[model samples]
Target chain A: MRIVVPAGGTGGARFVRGLLAALAEAGEPADVTVVGNTGDDITLWGLRVCPDLDTVTYTLAGAIDEAKGWGRPDETFTVRDELAGYGVLPTWFGLGDRDLATHLTRTSLLASGATLSEATATIAARWGLPGLGVTLLPMSDSPVETHVLVQHPDDPAGAPPRLVHFQEYWVGLRAAPRALDVVAVGAEQARPAPGVLEAVAAADVVLLPPSNPVVSIGTVLAVPGVRAALEASAAPVVGVAPLVGGAVVRGMADRLLPALGVEVDAGAVALHYGASLLDGWLVDTSDVHAVAPVEQAGIACRAVPLLMTDVPATARIAAEALRLAEAVRA
Target chain B: MRIVVPAGGTGGARFVRGLLAALAEAGEPADVTVVGNTGDDITLWGLRVCPDLDTVTYTLAGAIDEAKGWGRPDETFTVRDELAGYGVLPTWFGLGDRDLATHLTRTSLLASGATLSEATATIAARWGLPGLGVTLLPMSDSPVETHVLVQHPDDPAGAPPRLVHFQEYWVGLRAAPRALDVVAVGAEQARPAPGVLEAVAAADVVLLPPSNPVVSIGTVLAVPGVRAALEASAAPVVGVAPLVGGAVVRGMADRLLPALGVEVDAGAVALHYGASLLDGWLVDTSDVHAVAPVEQAGIACRAVPLLMTDVPATARIAAEALRLAEAVRA
Candidate 1:
């Protein structure tokens, strides 16, 4: 089946990385299309750093840092130290030596007038992922920076006033401050990345992995015509809850949930995705009580253990989600 | 006393590194100015690779490898290995991880419209140099590549002569093949690097280290006005012989000398530099007999035990060369 996955952060990437492997093991070849979120993209030290896009590329290449779950594995930070020596002010995001090479190569290509999509394709080819039979793509050629509105501890007004870049919030601050809003700053300006709509429409199944709703899948949906394409497609669109219960399985989703005014629970997450576009929603047994509410809202909800302890478990969960999706379509 | 040193390449750099320490110990502060050869300049994989200029910078920065005597000490090659995996071919020259950062910074600066000389100054400011208040300038803003004409051994019918870049000949082939010529391809068009001629003309004494007389020092003289500046300078220009007895100290200088139709001996080398520009010449005790021939050519000749075994010894050598220049001028 043609699967269109709109992934944003590491969580989304980890799931797809397994899904591709699972499909291969099952003797079923999948025509997989990825619409990566560009919202977290920023011009870092002059190189365009698309964290989400790199996550996908690294994961597919088997070069992703399995422990930290971002950047290339076995990387060095000589360039970061050198840049610091040059009196470059920001030293928050540590760019490693090998990683700096990719950023440099990408920046050089972009400087030469190639679109981001084309550059991504060239980079993907370098990773030797062609044999995987998956088409990876960024959501837009235009820049889209994700900015979070957080309540500053120093602010006497108690207002969530400042907008911080995603990397600053996640990597620098470690999401310590209480955030009130997460905005895709250039969402209105960003068009769907090339072939995003076509890939979505052609897909037989659209899977929304356990990525952050606000920043991961949210950023992909924010692009013009992408969400519309998913809604218009005949494929069974299934979403697996990022929030396993009343808490995030990984990452600092709990801290961000309050900022977006979304409840820190799987049921709320399914409801947040809404029933209009979602044909099936997978929830853990802890959130089974919320299934009726989701089904009543037109999404067929299934209660199952959703913690992906291992690759096999994650693939099984995907299969169960697909079955639920088929039931909803029937 | 001011010294004009036209240098670059590992040998030149390593010598200067030792000379800097030696000069400090001898309580002599040289108003040193380095006219770095830019013949090895290349834009590899879109990166401005100034092998010679970087050698001088790193040497002055005290970060050069004493063992390899080329790149940064304790250098890592993660980028080069990663590039290799990505099918980036012709990875002959080993660019260390820390070293690549320097190249990238330089390339980025150049791409942003800064002249090579301006970029060099900014890099120098990052690393504070002591006992060396030297102005480092490239031989030209326009690239001047050195090409090696070698007889192709693999060709069946004595096919047309094949020419390869200097790096390919020196680093890749290790200069084993029979070379027809060593041409400074673009030196004719290359302007004297900014402030080179002024440094040469204004110096009180100029001393050449035991650097590659053909490639390293030859590329500098190839620049448009550098030779003329040396000819007109009131300063006594003296050169230390790279050839100890009949053999080259390091690298394939003996092989290269033949390409220029010069014998690989101290007397032949001094004869090559000739009388008009050279007022002083330093030869080893082994070649003490050739001092008369050099003096007969209208240049002051000195016989010195010229092995740079240690810092003190190297300093003694520098002091001897300068003393000879002062004596000749008097």
Candidate 2:
């Protein structure tokens, strides 16, 4: 079976790892194509850093720090510390030594006129992504930065909200400030990277892992043609709820969902994607009440354990999502 | 007193350290401006690296590794090793983690439209060079890379020598091949960096450290206005021989001098600069025989122990050079 997954950095990466494990456990070869979110990408220390892309790639390659679900294993912050010593700013977003090599190669290639997808392919290949029967594709080759709008504490009651880069909100501010809005800058101008549309078009099932609905997957869908491609795909589209028990398993989904006027629940998130694009939605067993509310919105819904606590437990969740997709298949 | 020294990386940096010590020992507050050769500067990993300028700044700031005489003390090569793992080339040139910060900062500044001189000044200030009464200047703001022409081992009959970057010859090839010619690319078109000619012209005395004659000092003199400025200066110009006895204390000076058709002796190197440019020359006591030859060439020569065995020994050499400058002051 062919599975195409749209993923983010941390929570989505863990889900995808579980998906890979599930596919491997089937004792049959399966083609998995992961479309990584690039809205969280930023340039630091003169190096173009694609945090989400690297996270998914490293996770699948078995080079990721399993504990953090992002960055490389045995990573060192020697260079980052040195940069701090020189007073280079944004000290909050630390790029470790092993992680620096990826940025250096990507930045070098991009500087030499290679597109983001081309550079991504080269880096992913180094991690043997293709050999593992997984093809990782960037959402878009063009630059797209996610910006978060937040209320300024010092501003007057009627003053306009402050806008900062997504990283500035998440890493720099430690996600403390409330996000009034999340905007994916340049999303409209970006085209789906090479093989992205085709991967979804040819898949048996298009799965949305437990990734952030607003910034991660939402920003990717914000890109022109991506949502249309998914809607038009022959495969059944399935989404595993990022919110398990009315809260995110990881990341700040609760804070972000409210900004878009969506309730922080599995049912609201499913409705956010809507029944037209999502044929099947998977929620946690604890939120079994969300199943009827989601199904009433004209989407097939199922309740399963959604927490990716371990590989086996996560893989079971992925299997349940696929089973739901099969149940909703036309 | 105002003094100007034209210098290269290692030998010149050590000499300057000794010069600072000597001035302090004599209870003198000297405004010392060092004109660092930029010909050996190369772009590594897409970052502009100014080796000579960094050496002088680090040495003056007492941050240089005393053993290596260049780079930060207690430096690590984590990023460099990681780069090599990514199969980045020229693993031969190792940039320590701490040192990488300097290059990253410089590259970022240059990318943001700062000139080489401006970047050098900022970097020097970081090391408290200004408060120490020292100003570091690059020979030219514009790039002037030194390329060495060497014979190809594959060619039986002598064909025109193949030219490689000075770094490729020295670091990459380990300077094993004979240097047939040393050319400073872009030298003629390049103008001296800001305050370079002024530093030399307004000096109380101009000194040449025991740096490479051909590539180091030679490249600096290749800049159009620099030679003219030194000659027109009212201050006496004195040069310390890089060679001791019949050989250099360090570096490949003996092998390179012969390639330029100059004898590998103290007197021959003094004449190579010519009596018009050099008012006085200091040779090691073992090369006492060179005194007459250099004096006969219309230049005053002094024989002293030229080996910089330690900081104190180096200071004594600097004091002797100052005495020789006094004798030629006129």
Candidate 3:
């Protein structure tokens, strides 16, 4: 079977790891293509940084820091600290010494006129992604950064919200301030990277792996042709809830969800994606009541264990999602 | 007293450290301006790598690895090793992790339209050069790379002698190939970096440190108005011999000197600079035979113990050079 997974950083990377394990245990021959969210991409120290793409690549290569769920293992902060000492700004972003190698290679390639997709391919090749039966591609070659509009801290009395990069909101500010709005700048003009639409069109199964609906998966869908391709695809489209028990398993999903006027509940998120995009939605057993309300919205719903506590436990969640996809297809 | 020094990497950095000591010990209130060689500068992984300027800065800041005579103390090679893993070409240059921060800062500044001189000043400020009563400037603002024309190994029959970057020849190939010529590309059109000529004209004394004459001091002289400024300056110009007993104290001066039809002899080098630029030349005691010949060329010459075993010893060398400058002034 051919599977297409559109993903974000930590949670999405964990889900895909589980998906791979599930496929292997079932003895199913599968090819997986991951469309990484580029909205979280930022240029720091004049080097291009794609947090989601790097997290996924490192996780799959078994080089990720298991404790943090992002960045490389045994990383050093020599470069980051040195940059800080030089008084370079955006001191909040933790750019590790080992992780800087990826940015350096990517930036050099892009500077040499390679597209983001081409540069990503070159980096993924170093991790032997092809040998793992995985192809990782950014959502779009064109730059599309997610910016969050938040109320100015100093002027709480109805001042126009100031825009901050998604990373600045999430990593820098720790998602403290309420997000007034999230904008995927350049999404209207960005074309789906080469092989993205084809992967969606040719897949036997399309998975949205518990990524944030408002930013991660949502940003991917914002690309001009992406949502249209998913709507037109004949394959069963399945989504796992990033939220379980009315809270995000990881990341700032709960803080960001309210900005879209959507409840931080699983059923509300499925409705936000809607029946047009999702044939099947998997919510955690803790949010079992979400199943009925989600099904009422014309999208098939199933309640299962959604927590990615470990690979084995997460594999069960993946199996349940795949089972729901089969039922939706029938 | 105001002092101006033209210098390269390693040996030159060591000399400047001693010069500072010499001034301090003599109770001389001096403003030292170091005109650093920029010919060795290269863009590696799309980041500007300024070896000479960094060596001077790191050495003076006491952050230099004493053993290696260059790079930062306790430097990590994670970035360099990682870049090599990605199969990025030109792996011979060892860009350490801590050192990379300097390059990243410089590259970012230059990309943002800051001149090389301005970027160097910003970096120097971080190293507290101003606090040390030292000012470091690059030879020119315009990009000038030294390219060495060497007999291509594959085409030994001489296919017009291929040109390789100075770093490729010096660092990558270890300067093993015979150099046919050394060209400071862009020197003809290059103007001296701002403040270079002013520093030279205003100096009470100018000393050429024992750096590679062909590529280091020679390249600095190649900048359009620099040689003219040195000749027109009222200050007596003194130089320490990079060669002692017909051997280079450090670096590949022996391998590169033949290209300019100059012998690896201290006297020959002084004659190459000629009487117009050199008012006094300091040769090692072992090269005492060179003294008469250099003096016959109409440049005052002296023999001294030139081995810079440590800071105190190098301070003595600096003291001798200053004494020679005073004699020439009389």
> What are the DockQ scores of the candidates, in order?
0.30, 0.63, 0.79
TM-score of each: 0.88, 0.97, 0.98
**Distance from true position, residue A205, model 1, in Å?**
0.5
- Alpha carbon deviation, residue A299, candidate 1 (Å): 2.0
Error of 2 at A277 (Å): 1.1
Between prediction 2 and prediction 3, the one with superior TM-score is: 3
lDDT of 2 by residue, B5-69 (tens): 99999899999889999999999996899999999999988789889999998888899998888
Give the fraction of true interface contacts kept by model 3: 0.87
Model 3 scores a C-alpha lDDT of 0.92
User: Lowest lDDT 10-mer window, candidate 2 chain B?
Assistant: B82-91
Give the winner by DockQ: 3
Q: Pick the candidate with the highest lDDT.
A: 3
Judging by TM-score against the true structure, name the best candidate. 3
Model 1 gets an lDDT of: 0.81
Model 1, A1-330: lDDT tens digits are 888899976888777877876787778886788888888887766667878888888987788898887898887788677667766335688877777667767776787788999888888888865668778889888888888887655668856479889888888888988787898888898898788888988888999999888888888888888888888899999999888767888888888878878889888888888877799998998888878988888888899988877667877877777677678778
Better of 1 and 2 by lDDT: 2
Q: Write the per-residue lDDT of candidate 1 for residues B267-301, one digit (tens) a residue.
A: 78988988877888889999888899989988888
